[model samples]
Target: MSAAPLTLTVATPLRVWFDAVEIVSLRAEDASGSFGIRPGHADCVTLLAPSVVRWTCTDGTTRYCAVDGGVLLVSRGVRISIACREAISGDSLESLEAGVRSRHAEEDDAARRARVEQLQLHARAVRQMLRYLRPHPGGGADGPDGPGIGANPR
Candidate 1:
C-alpha cells in the first residue's frame, strides 16, 4: 500500500493561496533550517521564515512559493496548512528569490513610511490638545472663559 497524498493549503489574511494540493513530498524552510515532508510523517509545527516552500504538484511538477513569515501546521500527518501574511507563487527558485527580495524591500519601505505618518498624526493630535488646554486670556475656545472642560471658565 502506498502512502496517502498530502492535502496542502496555503492561506493568508486576505485570501486562500492554495486550497488543495496533492503531493508525494514537500520541502520547506523555516528559522532552524530546511526540512522535507512525506505522507504519514510525524505531525509538528514550524515557525517559517521568509523563504520558499516547495512541493511537487499532482501533475508531477515541482512548485514554489515565497512566504513572508508564518506558521506551518502538519496536522494528523496528512494535512499541511501554512498561515501567513503574504504568499507569492513562483515558477522557479532563483526567480522566486529575486522577486521576494525586491518585494520585501518595497514592503519594508512602505512600513517605515506608514510608521512615520502615524507618528506625525499622533504628534499633531497632542499639539492640538495642548493648545486647547493652555487656557488663553481671551474668551476663545482656548480661553479661560471658553468651553474648556474641567477648567474654571472665568
Candidate 2:
C-alpha cells in the first residue's frame, strides 16, 4: 500500500506562502543537519536554519521554499507546518538559491551596521562622562592640583 499524501504549509508572520498543498515528501535542514519527512513520520518539532525546504508534489514535480530560520512542526503524521520569519518560494531551484543568498547577505550587512552604530554611541557616552569627571586645568578647588577628587592635598 502507498503512503498517504502529506499536506504542507509554509507561513510567515505576515502571510502564508504555501497553504494546505498536497505533497508526497518533504526535506529540510536544521542545526542537526538534513532530514526528510514522509506521510507517516512521527510528530515532532524542529528548528529550521536559514535554508531551503524542498518537497515533491503528488504529480512528481518538485518545488522549493527558502526560509530565514523558523520552526517546523509535524502533526498527526500527515500535516507539516513551517513558520518562518521570511519565506521565498520558487519553481526554479537556481533562482531560489540566489535570492536566498542575497537576502541573507542584506540582513547580515544591516546587523553589522547596527552593531557598529551601537558601539559608537557607547563610546561617545563614555567620552562625555570622562570629560565631566576630569579635573579642570586652571588650578582652583576643582583643579588637578587643588584639594579635590583628583588633587593632592598639601
Candidate 3:
C-alpha cells in the first residue's frame, strides 16, 4: 500500500522545519481523552504533551521524536502544524540520541534551575494526561504529582 502523506512543521529556536512524510502515528489530547490520528483524519486542533512521536518514511524507516509541549493542528489531507516548545527531529537517530545526552549534562544555576523545575512540573502533568490518554508500552499511568515527562521521575 502506498503511504499517506502528511506535513510536519517543527518550530524551534529561530527556525522552523517543514517536511512532508508518511505519518505513522499521532497521539494528542482531546476533550474525551487521548486520541490517535492516522491518514485521512478529520481536521482538528489539540494540546500536545511531552512524549515520543513516531513516523515512518516512504522507505519503511521508522523514526522517533521527542516533543516537549505544543499545539497540534491536523487537517483532512494529513497536514499538521505543531507549535511546540521543542521538537527533536528523528533523523539520524544516533546523533539525536547523542544530542539528548549532551543536553542533559548541562546544569543551570539557582534561578534558572527554579524555572526549569516549574516547567518540569508542567511537563509531568502533560505526561500524565498522555498516559491516561494513551498508555505507553510497559507501564501504568503515572501518579498525578509525578515528575515531569523529561525530568528524573524519582
Off by over 4 Å in 3: 1-4, 22-35, 91-97, 107-154
Cα shift from native, residue 24, model 1 (Å): 1.5
- lDDT, model 1, position 109: 100
Model 2 is weakest, by summed lDDT over 10 consecutive residues, at 139-148
Point out the higher-scoring one by TM-score: 1 or 3. 1
lDDT tens string, model 1, 103-149? 87998999999999999999999997888777556544553444775
- Candidate 1 residues lying further than 4 Å off, grouped into runs, are 112-154
* Per-residue lDDT of model 2, residues 1-154, tens digit only: 8988999999998999999999999999999999999989999999999888999999999999998899999999999999999999888899898887787799999999999999999999998767656766754235343355655455
RMSD of 1: 4.5
lDDT of each: 0.86, 0.90, 0.66
By lDDT rank, best first, the candidates go: 2, 1, 3
Instruction: For candidate 1, list the clashing residue pairs, or say none.
Output: none
* Candidate 1 lDDT score at position 30: 89
Clashing pairs in 3: 124-148
Error of 2 at 90 (Å): 1.2
Clashing pairs in 2: none
